[model samples]
Target: MAANKLYIGRKVRDLRQANRATQAQFAERLGISVSYLNQIENNQRPVSAGVLVALAEKFRIDLAELSGGEGDRLVSALSETLTDTLFDGYTPSLQELKLVTQNAPGFAHALIAAHRAYRHNSEQLASINDTLGRSLAAAETTPYEEVRDFFHFVDNYIGDLDMLAEALAAEIGIGDADPGPVLSGYLERHYGVRVARATQNDDLVRAYDPEARLLTLNPYLPAPTRHFQIALQIAQLHAEAVVDSVAAGAGFRTTEAYEICRIGLHNYFAGALLLPYRRFMAAAREVRHDLDLLAARFGASLEQVCHRLSTLQRPGQKGVPIFFARIDRAGNITKRHSATRLQFARFGAACPLWNAHQAFESPGRITRQLAETPDGARYLCLSMQVSRGGRGFRQPQQHYALALGCEVSYAENFIYADDMDLTNASAYDPIGISCRICERTQCASRAVPPLKGRLVIEHNMRRTIPYSIRPAGDAPQS
Candidate 1:
């Protein structure tokens, strides 16, 4: 085969396995000998044009699937992983990466998994110190982080669970209005579980007595919170099978992780039940994804509506691909989910230049920012403050900034991006994953030096940043 000839043995093997056909069966269907098929599948020979046509005709496989999407994604992910400081900047050539992706995809995936595990351990150690890592290298990942990684890999979308929640919503006659009343009625009539409000002494946001068939919610809790708690209870009581089904293959590190994942799934179902996908997507389009309007229409809080918007990635009926995160006053990410290519840092705070931190200062108002990542991806980010706990003077309000953002490609669909100059590079703030990992030295907000570069401290001279950093191999500055 010529170098330019197409070799999609991996894709061919995938299609054959998908159809559950042996090499002989597949070869016969394609009107080819088993030996020739074997050669093609093993990349010993290029797939002929005739074989491509035969494949489309027999298996109805889209030729586009064979055009290296998964390979490209694998290459990109592998490249990103290898560029981490842990790999010492030893990035493989693009051609080498392509070979790994196409010829040894399973091994490539294993490498990615090991890299993720390594990154997880590094993050855990960063929180404490390297001393803990030296002795207890085996037990590096925590339960919360393990579950978070599972969701992160899945793009925070559970297809079957989403569908199940949508179906339950429809079956219960819940629509683009308050789901609380309907959910309460359904619980009482079907499960004989009566919903009630708890007094101050209850000191719980939500409590359910299964034996008594009672669900007690904090009376002072926000309406959306109350409804969410009710729906979560419904998920735990009725949708355990679906939750367990999703949890079974999640590869959780501990029982706590498994249970926490179930809660997360139930919370997902609750959100789906409250803001049903079809109606929410339609309303979001009508309003151009205005968070306040969507909140009012769906009877959800700004945070709830924003969080729900990120999970609208159904197979055919997808909405704007977005990332949603919640951060506290101290910059701790309380909740994070993203359907976009941009991923949150597994440990440490987000980039200081990101607008999410400013949301705390401007409470009850939406802060809009045009931000670009180190990878050159731009996003239209919206952030607003969310407050919890207001029962008494002693109960101080817990403030969190909820950030909702989408890639700049979808900026036209967002009301927040209306007046921003999306084309101008200067309009966007340069943000990165974290200070320790970020390579941008020009940032005045950088608290520490980057992990990849060698720091050069000048005793007599000081730039805007404390120290100058250059790539490891670069000659010393004159």
Candidate 2:
């Protein structure tokens, strides 16, 4: 959103490499000098509009492919990472950060990776102060966090696997009639794997034994979940090589992380297989993103539907960019992904004022909120509680609230946005990423002071909060 000249060096370089073209060859194709092309690829020169048009014409590429989406995402992530107190006095300007993301994205990624390693080390140190050896020796990040970052950076869309799964979906006639029986039949006939639904409560939604060629699914699990699990098993058995290649290319440091990423990719593939991209996107548009209707039609759960919606970042067929997060009752974020500019806090917990937390009290209802972040971006947020496999009283029930949101500009496309006063400023709740980095000084629920602010305490006078935060650069109050 800055006025700086766009420098898409990394993208251009990647494009050239993807086409297996050298600098001279690529320049020749673009009708530009080799030196000029080299400069553009190296970020020494900004990409001209003519070159951009030429690239589009010659390569048959979508002009949107060269847009600032990835750069903006990188800037958001780097900006969040730099918000740490560890980077005090080292925060770069927004323009400077954008330059890094546009030109030297590899370095931007490295900086983020280093910061993650530092945070992981700090957490390890806090948990095991007595065992200094174990804490200091581990320089790598948590496998789960690494995998989460992978999905986050990739915009939650795996093109190859998505296409593969979509083809499978078409082949198996998914999303038509009851998917459970269809998938079960496919597994039995194709893989020679028997699928059995367990009536008794063993607390296992899906248990697959490859050696025995059997999959035992909990009967109590919703039909949608069973169908998804069958799809997942199929993904693992059907496209192990594709998933493995993707995981390998992800550059995970540990085997644990690689295995986790493999499973995550399989799960992603399963979701894609059930709700294939093009058809699902079409359905979402047709239904105005009504989660309940979409779920019923696609034989998926509310959470699955929302999660699939978040991953609609396929090249030209992109859906309205939205952010999705799932949080437990304890306020701990179980899953968070954003295709929008709004990124959730990577710290302790999400902002309490966020409507996602409000869904717990309302259970079956969809809680709608018009929220404005500190950066002044307005979002039409929707939340609802989703139950995940805990039917028996003896079994511990796991419940999490699912949140879906997009910029208010896209509100008309969202079914839950109906009947809301989206134009009224007062209807929108002010929210922040987290307490520690939030610039807001007047939030009643402020639990901690911002890193850049000084606390103003008055023993004689009290306000909503015990102390007022005096942000940096403010003169003595008039």
Candidate 3:
């Protein structure tokens, strides 16, 4: 067996520089010679066990960072991006990507930033073309998508913020039965903010008064939304230090993306505080991952429960690795995060075959589907329809679908998977990221032809699945 290798020289160097210490001075703290420290910092030698301990003891560095947590995330994201057809034949090997991550993380990050810009611009052009009633060009990235990618690159897990929120939740005596009072108490005592429900404009859900120190929530808002708004406000005020610290280093290109990133992180902390990871995971297991039961237990709604389930990615103690997504009636993915290999499309709507889109037809009901991606991975998906803005007769409600799922291998962990025919290949519905990127040739529901493939015009025959595609290279079919 190969021995464990630790290459955290860059991180060590960063810590040393941050403290304004030279090699000799830092080496003295670690009880190492200056030459040895230089060798370690330059990656000529791996960080020794003794140096690792010294880092934690003297510098108070997080051991996890030294374990390549950030590097691993970068490698995963870069690997995913390389899978795009734009780089089809040029995808680098995993070991090569890891080398880039370890040696030049900045360069790796630069490459990702460039790709995001290209992707965003492409998506924007597509949106413009759609609005002008022209043929869809390509999908440009949204600020939401940019922030989503930022979170996705980090595996959607913010370790420091999550831990801090967990500790705060425990300190405030936040119980599962009624967490609202605990959250409200914390806001009142610490920030001098009073939480109350009041009449608001039809479009406005929450309003906060700075001078009066009042948080006014719409009474018509659902119980979950109201509680969530309170928790979100608490995060904005209390978790700003930690949230700002992370955001400062996240490499967001635009101001909008950066602001959205902060809001997303604050919301994440709120969910962590509301659910309180340890207790929620225990309840998840006890109930066999029943969404309804978990929601009731946590005094949350089903959507909140599903979102919380996806964020149970604490290192060493993780719950089911699920993906959560919210899609509007028009098929635009409003929100998404995946812990599994099934990546949502960054450009446009999800695959039409995904059960979440079908959820609109059966509002308020949970729908299940065993889905197989073009890559042959199978998932057990559970989707539910939800709505907002239905306060008055004239106010139109915006409907959406919430989906949660994981790989079929983890199917046994979810109650929704009990009745699924996991062993039957035919049971799984065929799905892909989007029509432009999907390589499926004979899909009946394919909205457009694959962007990188040849479309054969069959003037002689009629077929249920239009546009037979010959992608890149293959023998001509009769």
Ranking of models by TM-score: 2, 1, 3
In the range 5-120, model 3's lDDT, one tens digit per residue, is: 67667778888999999999999999999999998887778887788888889977656546634465567556656655677546476557766887787788778767877775
Instruction: Extract clashing residue pairs from model 1.
Output: none
The C-alpha lDDT values of all candidates are 0.81, 0.87, 0.80
Evaluated at residue 22, the lDDT of candidate 1 is: 98
The reply for model 2, stretches above 4 Å from the true place, is 1-7, 16-59, 124-140, 472-478
Q: Give residue 56's error in model 3 in angstroms.
A: 20
**On a 0 to 100 scale, what is the lDDT of residue 165 in model 1?**
84
Backbone clash count, each prediction separately: 0, 0, 6
lDDT of 2 by residue, 1-478 (tens): 7645767887899999999999989999999999999888877888888998998899888787686365567787788888777766676787678778877778999999898888877777777857765636565677998899899889899999999999988998987778988898999999999998776788777888889999998878777888888999999998899999999999998899999999999999999999999999999999999989999999998989999999998886788888999999898888988877788777678898999989999999999999999888899999999887567678787899999999998899988888999999999999998887898999998878887666788999999989988755466575
lDDT of 1 at 288: 98
For candidate 2, which ten residues in a row score worst on lDDT? 131-140
CA shift of 373, model 2, Å: 1.2
Candidate 1, residues 238-307, lDDT tens digits: the string is 7889899899787666798899898889999999988888888999999999888998887888888988
Model 2's lDDT to the true fold? 0.87
1 against 3, candidate with superior TM-score:
1
Candidate 2 vs. true structure, TM-score? 0.89
